[model samples]
Target: MANKLSQLDQVFAALADPTRRAIVMRLCAGEASVGELADPFAMALPSFMKHIHVLETSGLVQSEKSGRVRTCRLSPDALLGAEDWFQQQRAIWEARLDRFEAYVMKLKKEKEQAAAKRPSRTARKKGS
Candidate 1:
């Protein structure tokens, strides 16, 4: 669906940045105030807030403001859509590879059989 793809696009785009990815990783352990999350990064708070905005837009994170502090948490099912897509792709590729392997084995067996039916060089030389 268009909506699903849009969400996927947003999620991937947000995660494409290492800073945003780090914020997401930190949130995985537990929710934290924006200040706490920004503490580990060298960027300015405003710059870090930009990354937070992307994460929120992607629906991978949710933030709540309590007094002057903003806290962020990983939204439930943050990566579920991406994970499902990867699993589907893996299954498709694995099936294709298995079929290719079977085709290759079949060709090898046929080649061996054909070689077996041919005369050896020494036998041909002796006949000539």
Candidate 2:
């Protein structure tokens, strides 16, 4: 559906940035405050916040603020659409490759059969 594809597009787009991807990776272990997440990067808080914003917009991350601290966590559901798309593509390619392999094997067998039916050069020379 269009909605699914749109979500997939957003997820992929968000993940396209290394910073955003790293943020997601860090969240995988557990949720962390915005300051903790930004510690590993060399950029300023505002710059890092932009990456967080993109992830939040893409639905790949969820953040909540309590007091002065903002904590972010990964939203696993956002990735499901992308995962399903990849699985579908893998299945289709696997099927096509299997068919191609079968066709190649059939051709090889037919070639061998034709070769077996032909007379050898040695046989022709002996006949002559």
Candidate 3:
């Protein structure tokens, strides 16, 4: 469906950034406060927050504000769609490659059989 495709697009687009990817990786271990998430990067908090915004928009992350602190967590389901898409592509390519290999092998066998049936130059010369 169009909605699924749109979500896939958003997830891929958001993960295209290394910063955002790193954030997701960190969140995989457990949820972290905004400050905790921002600590590892050298960029300003405001700039770092832009990455979080993108992640949130992609549905790859969710955050809750408690008092003045915002904590973020990874949404594993968001990644499932992308994973399914990749698996489908892998299966299709693998099957196509298998068919191609079979075709090549068949051609090779035919050529070998044809060569075996032909007479050698030396044999033809002796006959002449």
Candidate 4:
């Protein structure tokens, strides 16, 4: 779990930059060449390439160069660690919620049972 958390941290930190997020979003649709990825950012090719480097280092993206062009693609495996971390968090939260719900239901049932045990005014009058 600790390792998973660390990996999640790396993944999210890498994505914290707008350029990196944009790159990821672009890759979500399909793989693209570096030039194509850089086209919309209005940044120099070198600067944009740095963003790709960060993404690749964080394991969120993969790149391959063929001839003069470099193409990048999203790596689905990179998300697995983050997803595991989230699932652990969710499981803990759900367990707590479930316990709370059970406690509330138990209290409600106890209250109803107590109310049933109380003598009615008619019963009190008859006893008197």
Candidate 5:
């Protein structure tokens, strides 16, 4: 569990940067060279490299240097921790909603029971 949370932290931290997020999204298509990744952004090569470095440090992406070019690929497994956390959050919310629904139904039943036990409005008006 600790390991999972750590991974989640890293994933979230890495994705928090817009440039890093864009790099991840691009890698989703397949692998891309650092030069190719930088082409779409207006930032200088050195500045863009910093974003790639963050993604690499977070374990969200891995890069290989071949010849003079560095190619990066998305690491899908790194997202597992984040997905698990989201699933747990969703489950908790669903359970709370279900409990609320049951409580409402119980209250409705109690209301109906009380109405049945009470005298009719017409009978009360006649007596008054």
Candidate 6:
């Protein structure tokens, strides 16, 4: 569990930057050489490589060196852990909301029952 959380932390951190997110988004279509990936950005090559490094470290990307080029590909199932965590949170919140709705309904029913048992203003005036 701790390991999973740590990995998720890294993944989220890697994805926190718009640059890194864009890189990942591009990789989604297919693998690309380092040069191709770096071409679209205005930053220096070294600076761009740092973003790639972060993605590689987070297991969201994998790169291989061939001849003079480094090609990067999105790791298979890289986002699965984060997706699972989100699903778990969604289920928990939905359950809590369901319980809250039931509680509110119960309160409304009790209030209505109480009101039904009480005398109306017209009846009190008549009695007076």
**Top model by lDDT, which number?**
3
TM-score of 4: 0.80
Ranking by TM-score: 2, 1, 3, 6, 5, 4
Which residue pairs come into collision in candidate 3? none
Scored against the true structure, residue 61 in model 6 reaches a CA lDDT of: 99
Model 1 misplacement above 4 A: 125-128
Give the worst 10-residue stretch by lDDT in candidate 5.
1-10
> 53-121, model 6: which lDDT tens digit per residue?
999999999999999999999995879999999999999999999999999999999999999999999
> Each candidate's lDDT (Cα)?
0.93, 0.96, 0.97, 0.91, 0.91, 0.95
> lDDT per residue, candidate 1, 1-128, as tens digits?
99998998999999999988888889889999999999999989989899999999999999999999999999958688898889999999999999999999999999999999999999999999
Model 3's TM-score against the true structure: 0.92
User: Weakest 10 consecutive residues, lDDT, candidate 3?
Assistant: 115-124
List pairs with backbone clashes in candidate 2. Answer: none
Would you give me the overall lDDT of model 6? 0.95
Q: Give the lowest summed-lDDT range of ten residues in model 1.
A: 76-85
Candidate that scores best on TM-score: 2
lDDT of 2 at 81: 91
Q: Which residue pairs clash within candidate 4?
A: none
Order of models, best lDDT first: 3, 2, 6, 1, 5, 4
- lDDT of each residue in 2-119, candidate 3, tens digit only: 9999999999999999999999999999999989999999999999999999999999999999999999999999999999999999999999999999999999999999998999
Each candidate's TM vs. the true structure?
0.92, 0.96, 0.92, 0.80, 0.88, 0.91
lDDT of 1: 0.93
Compared with the true structure, model 1 gives a TM-score of 0.92
Clashing pairs in 1: none
CA RMSD for every model? Answer: 1.3, 0.9, 1.4, 2.6, 1.6, 1.4
lDDT of 3: 0.97
Taking the tens digit of each residue's C-alpha lDDT, what string does model 2 give over 1-128? Answer: 88878888999999999999999999999999999999999999999999999999999999999999999999999998988999999999999999999999999999999999999999999999
Query: Residue 57: error of model 5 in Å?
Result: 1.2
Query: What are the clash counts of all predictions, listed in order?
Result: 0, 0, 0, 0, 0, 0
Model 3 stretches astray by more than 4 angstroms: 121-128
